[model samples]
Target chain A: MRNLWLFLSKYNAFFFFIIFFSISIVLFVRNNSFQRASVLNSSNQIVGKAYETTNYLKSYLNLAVVNDSLAAENARLRGEMKSAFYSDSIVKREIVDTIQHQQYSYIVGEVVNNSIHHKDNTITINRGRKHGIKKGMGVISPTGVVGLVLNVSDNYSTVQSLLHSDTRISACIKENNAFGSLTWGEENYDPMVALLKDIPNHVKVTKGQHIITSGYSTRFPKGIAIGRVRRTGVKGGESFLNIEVQLSTDFSTLQYVYVVNNLLAAEQEQVEAIQPAK
Target chain B: MIRIIINNLIRFVVLVFIQVFLLKNIGYYNLATPFLYILFVLLLPFETPNILLFVLSFLLGLTIDTFYDTLGINAAATCVLAFVRIIFINLTVQRQGLETEPEPKLGIMGFRWFFFYTLILTLFHHLTLFLLETFTFSDIKYTLIRVVLSSIFTIVLVLLSEFIFFRKKER
Candidate 1:
């Protein structure tokens, strides 16, 4: 013990420096911004795998909440099927109803990781190219629009969450068809609110009205609900109504979202390209 | 020994609070701000255990990192500073002073020795920290300016504290 202490005392500075300095360098390279899209990211393979492990351990604790949301979704789906059968009066409810469309298909996936506090927040899902997920695809929960896919690796995909400052989604007022883009305000703090802008002065708007995606770009389908207008305003001399939209998706509680794959996106882009400059 | 531990513990808490709450809010222009928490690493007793110095500086850097959200940057720079500290002491303090003056406060060490010691160490720390923060050679000029200005700013604060607290010899 005396000899060990003597050795450590003699060389402890060099010893400790070597240990801590290597750890710092390891973390430094891992956290470098250029490597953001790699496995070093918060939602990349390494951290995602860790989160999944932890969630697996604690999932039983959250069984009730998970069951409740799943039950609600299942009930909604069953109700819609019943209504469809009754209204159609063609195929009996016994026959399976498959209303699959070629244009847009949803790939359900779990949010392996997510963040909200950063200027540019991102979400990562277990779904990837292996699961027909691709970049620029729109992600939505059962309740509302989640975000657009920013980057995708083989087994994972990162989403540009709505909480990000630069995330702009095309939105339209449900009551009046007044279209605008939704953006997170400069101050992205508690109770995250998106600013809906560019609706002309002529269109009537009101608080608590539903705003939804316009399907302008092939990212989101038309009428995918986004948020409700919380506060309304007018910027200086601009002939547009400036409004704050309280996003319906409570990002903190988000667990699962469906990645929207627009199979016809390429065709749409090609068709739009042929149009001469107006 | 206990008194030394108590004093250092108190200084750690006070300097961290001052750096995070007070000095952090005093950003006059966009570019440069003083980092007073380096004073904790600077003023540690000369004869403190090498392991303790390393650990203390690591914790101090991590605390500042928590405030700035520049994770790993401060910790690495501060670790470098702490590693270089023993060499700095060897270079600056005379053998007689090391024996007589355990704690090399400016009042005891006299103005010139104190200035040179603080200036060089502070510059080394600021250079490492700002370089890590930028981590790019393209803005070398801007980074150098930041290093120089912030080092001077931190030095001034350290000297001010030394004069305020240690001027009277508590015989």
Candidate 2:
């Protein structure tokens, strides 16, 4: 205390000068226009740059969450695609879902067992009654109609493969409605070809024409793509056309299939029973 | 001792009034403010205490600022002047009259010594004040012009007043 007082009294003039000089400076800064403008401008520039950097960092941090939501949304929309159904007449605009009731509801399942190399090939699916799959329900791959469900358990079902000998399906050419009974012979184990019979020889048939299911029975829907016509010939005096078809389903890589849930299958079966033999 | 105090008080008032009301009002040459008030600092007794000298000079410059609406430029310059005035007198005046405190008049301090003293100190005061006011070297030319013109005028005025009034005191 004593030293400080001594110093103050000794350099009292210098201290007083400094005090008064500071006061003058404060007043000058408050009053001067140019100094005020320069101070505010530089300070604002620094603050604005800091805010912009923080905003950039915030957006970068949120990018992962944004990407996750986009992937989930794509998965949801894939389930509602028109090509995944038994009908292609419905166009894929946004949600005209009110017009489509339960004409077809598909139970998606993976093929647990597929035997394409055998003469009596059969497929085992990982879906059954618990998933609304029943006997006589049609199954299909993304590219073509596969077969009908023959038996069911609690959690599994068996489908008669289109590659089997006794299996027969009615098919028609897309261009001309010249339908025939589709069959695979005992020797037809190539897994890529089938035969369409009963097409009249006089009916015009073209190679490379698309063949689709004729919906003659309650088993499958009409217009389900079966395959494409690969070859057509009439033996010397045969009354019917022998047409070879290339199966659209690539059996070697078959993994997923959808089982059709026909809402009126029981009613249609009962109505068919009363028809007399033609 | 009382008479010296009274005389300095009178000189302080007279110089401040003349600087604020008369000299500063006339914008002579647009660059020169004939700051003859520093004459008070020049004429203060050589033996004046350092603290008192600094305070007197600060107050003198602040008084001029209040009139001219300038806040700190004059106060800071005058405070520096007050401090320098003491060292200046000690350097210029001889040790022959060591015991007695002689007034820094043209008669007591020889004219040659006083002229140089006034010229140097006045230039210092003008430099400090103008530098404070501009506060930048970007317009150094303008600062230099203001200091030179104003210092020359202040030096002449300080010499004139000393010759006119202090001559009567010396006689």
Instruction: Point to the candidate with the largest TM-score.
Output: 1
Q: What is the lDDT of residue B117 in candidate 1?
A: 81
- Candidate 2 lDDT by residue in tens digits, B69-116: 355667778877875676676676677774554687887767898899
TM-scores, all candidates, are 0.57, 0.41
lDDT of 2 at B110: 70
Colliding residue pairs in candidate 1: none
Candidate 1 yields a Cα-based lDDT of: 0.77
lDDT of 2 by residue, A165-253 (tens): 66889888988998888898433446789999999988888888999998777667788889898999996898999899999887645
TM-score of chain A of each: 0.78, 0.63
Per-residue lDDT of A39 in model 1: 41
